[model samples]
Target: MTQLDTAPARLSPAEPSVAEPPAASAVARLTTASPLGRIVVEGDGSAITRLEIERAGALSTDGLPDAPDDLTRRAVDQLGEYFSGSRHDIDVPVRLTGTPFQRAIWEGLRAIPFGATRSYGELGRDTGRATAGRAVGGAVGANPVPLIVPCHRVLASDQRITGYSAGDGVPTKVWLLDHEGIAHR
Candidate 1:
């Protein structure tokens, strides 16, 4: 029999604490209930940095002011309209944080017109990498902002559903696509 060794790791004194992010990266967050569940929006006064659907937990916004800025308010309102099927587009500015390829993929995703979906191969071709469908899929999967970037509009080559990173996964994706009147294979 082999014996396993376990020991606690020690942190260097110069290292920053991992419990909280740096002051410059500190974000104010707000939570709103949607048809899908709670949506957490994080940003400062300028742009929305992150938007995530919470399936298991909620971010507390107890003492925080309700949408302290116009951008946040617009985001919440647009999301509301989107869920209600009254709005088909979102106009709020998003502060995209990712690599150049990821940003390009996100731009391509945004270009997928409402109620329409494109295959991963088609999206790759549109991004000027016709032979890089797998690479395109990787970037698509890395999308941090889902609904805003519209990554769900990208599908498999057979026009079938694929992976989704938010709100109940593929089922939520189906609901969103259905809400937009998109028919998939």
Candidate 2:
């Protein structure tokens, strides 16, 4: 199993208001090559905010910092370890911004053990929305941090690859699943 920070997955209603808004200069970014493809990671100094896998076109890093901040550098290193198969889980602080339902689904995704797969219905049920498989899938696709959050671990009820939004789509998912030794069609 991948180790994860024990921070509460759900953000309290007052939490957002408690912290001051980050300045424009607070955003930090880095792009690196991985086994899947080129990846762009953005952070707000303290926590990761976004991670994107480049597909046909390179993901824009406009206006972001030319050098990675300490956090981003660490994330990149962890990603390298993951790709090399030395790290099963990435333990980084992530600030996920999304609807309550989406956050719930993301947390559920994180709970899936390394090399294990979960159906969309199973994920929905785990997130307390058992009948919202479609909604669960939507939230999964919207996940900004794919590998770190392990969205590739989700599959259809029949344990078949449904689709993937990051990198080369289903092929990217296949690579990740195969790396983790997951069984899927």
lDDT of 2: 0.79
Residue 18 in candidate 2 has what lDDT?
A: 21
lDDT of 2 by residue, 1-185 (tens): 12122232222222222234356556788999998778988878777778999887667674455568998898899999999999888877777777777777788887777899889999888767899978998999999888878899999989899999998899999999999999999
Give the Cα error of residue 106 in candidate 2, in Å: 0.4
> Model 1 over residues 58-126: C-alpha lDDT tens digits?
434445665445666677888899898897777665666566566666767777778988888887777
Clashes within 3 Å, all models in order: 0, 0
Note the Cα lDDT for every prediction shown.
0.69, 0.79
The best candidate in terms of lDDT: 2
TM-score (C-alpha) between model 2 and the true structure:
0.86
Task: In model 1, state the lDDT of residue 109.
Answer: 76
Report the number of the highest-TM-score candidate.
Answer: 2
Off by over 4 Å in 2: 1-25, 62-65
Residue pairs whose backbone atoms clash in candidate 1: none
Minimal lDDT window, size 10, model 2: 9-18
